[model samples]
Structures are given as structure tokens and as C-alpha cells.
Target: VCVPPESVQPPPGSHLPHLSSRVMANLDDGTQIGLAMSRSIGDPEADRLGVIPDPTVEVMDVGALVQEAAEALKVESEDEVELLAVSASDGLFDHVTPETVALEMARSLYEKEGAPRPLLAAERLIMLSSRFWIEPQQVAYRDDISLAVTKVNKGGKVKA
Candidate 1:
């Protein structure tokens, strides 16, 4: 029976000549290769036979990666960590410390007890605000005073 025109017609523009064999065998490895009918390389029946290039495999530069890792380790692990992070509520103040707060409290208490009459709110605030900061420890004491002042400012009565 005569084959259909669509089935018999070769691919467009590939110049590979039609050899006797349905599949061309490689002399080096006896593996068979088919014609490139799907590719747009002109007529396949007249195309010349040649060696196809093999896919390349790339090698990773492991020595460079190791050197970079060693440098990073050397830099990061050199010195001891300096400043330790602490919570804000850990008796630390912006400018006053716990010892200074204690000293101020002592001074205020001494002034209050020495006074013949009770101190007014303005007078108490004046005593607290007049304190000068000397060190971080002093500022830390003021942290407690800050809390106390916050409570008082919020309309909570200060306990004796």
C-alpha cells in the first residue's frame, strides 16, 4: 500500500542525506542515532554526519570556600563580647543610679524629718528633681525613684 504524503514527507531544510540504515550507528560505541526531524536545520536527508559535543561537568572550587570559611571564623571568634544587653526594668536609669537614688532618698528623708511641718507636693518634687547624676550606679537607683514618681504622677498616693 502507498504511504500517506504527511507520513512520508521529510522535515524542512535539514540537509542530512538518506543513508541505507533507519538509525545511524556510532562506530566508537555502536550506539544508534536518529535524524533530527524536529529541528529547523534545513533538510535532514542531506545533512552531513559529524561528532556531537558532550555535555560539560563543572568542578566546585572547594579550596576557596574553605579559605573563606577559615577567614570568617578567625574574624568573628577573636574578641570577647563587651556590652551585655539587659532589660529596661533591671533597675537601670537614663541618668541616675540606684545608689544615687538611695542617697537622694536619704537626703529627702533627712530634710523631711528635720522640717517641723509636713512637706507639700511641690517641695517633694523639688527635692527629687534637684539631684545631679554622678555615675551609672547612681542612675540605677533613680530607676526605682522613676517608678515611684510614675506611680505618684499617675495619682497614686506615695506610701510613707
Candidate 2:
């Protein structure tokens, strides 16, 4: 569920900056969800804004996730596999940024299982562009190496 940005309270000693009241007021009339900012993510703008990184790390069964994805993509048992991690967020102040979620997921997987590196090194990370005015109701998953390569080559820009 989404909440107004004003309703989100930063944790104690958090160095992250909150969204300005003016920006909050200018948002659509729908509930606002603030995205957690990370100053240490090496983004100059994020550091300048004093955004705090998300602290929550949710660990999932990577094998299970991969299996589900493989099944959905109709891959054969002997097919080579790569894992693409995608995070989706409704464009709102209260929602966590898709980058943060994707990063945390990769970090957690690396620390726990140590297999996603080869997958990630193969350029398998994907972050869906934040959607405005609509939440994702369903996703059509496909494994398109050419598309992924093109996105990476273009500096990760998703065409609308």
C-alpha cells in the first residue's frame, strides 16, 4: 500500500533527505510513496541530496526464482541459463527505487549463494522503468539477449 510522503519518517540518524514539501504537494492526488535514496551508491545527485540507502535485504530462493523464470520462458533442461533481476516500482515518493531493490537483491544473492556474479557479469541485470499512474498488474517475461545487450549498449535507457 502507498502512503503520503509526509507520512514517512526517516529512521533515527538517517542522513537521507526527504522530498521537499513543494514537490510533495505537486504530486498527483494519489497516495505518494517516497523512494529511499542512497548517498553511497556513487551517484553525485544522490549524495548531494543526502538520500539514505535502503537497509532492508530480502533473501529469496534464487534457484526457485530461476526455475520459475525458466519455466515461464519455456527453456529446455539442457539449455544454458542466465538470470536477469528486474525490480518494478510505481513512480511515487513512498516507493523504493527500482535500482535500490535490484542492487539489494544482487548483493544479497552474492553474499548468500555466490552464483549471480557470473550471471550478472554476463549483463543480466534489468531495472524496469518506473511507471506513472499505473501499477503493474502482470508481466510478460522473455529472454531476449539482443534486447538486453542493446539496452546495456545504450546505457540502460528503456524506450517508451
Top TM-score hit: 2
- Clash pairs, model 2 backbone: 33-93, 33-94, 33-95, 34-93, 34-94, 37-52
**Local distance difference test values of all predictions, in order:** 0.35, 0.41
Candidate 1 residue lDDT tens string, 7-126: 544577766423222224455676656543222234444333322233233554544544564576565631211111111222234334555543444344345455322234324443
Residue lDDT tens for model 2, 90-158: 232234454554454445444546545434532433323223213442444222221111111122334
The residue ranges of model 1 lying beyond 4 angstroms of the native Cα positions read 1-92, 111-145, 149-160
lDDT of 1 at 33: 60
State how far residue 143 of model 2 sits from its true place (Å). 30
What TM value does model 1 have?
A: 0.18
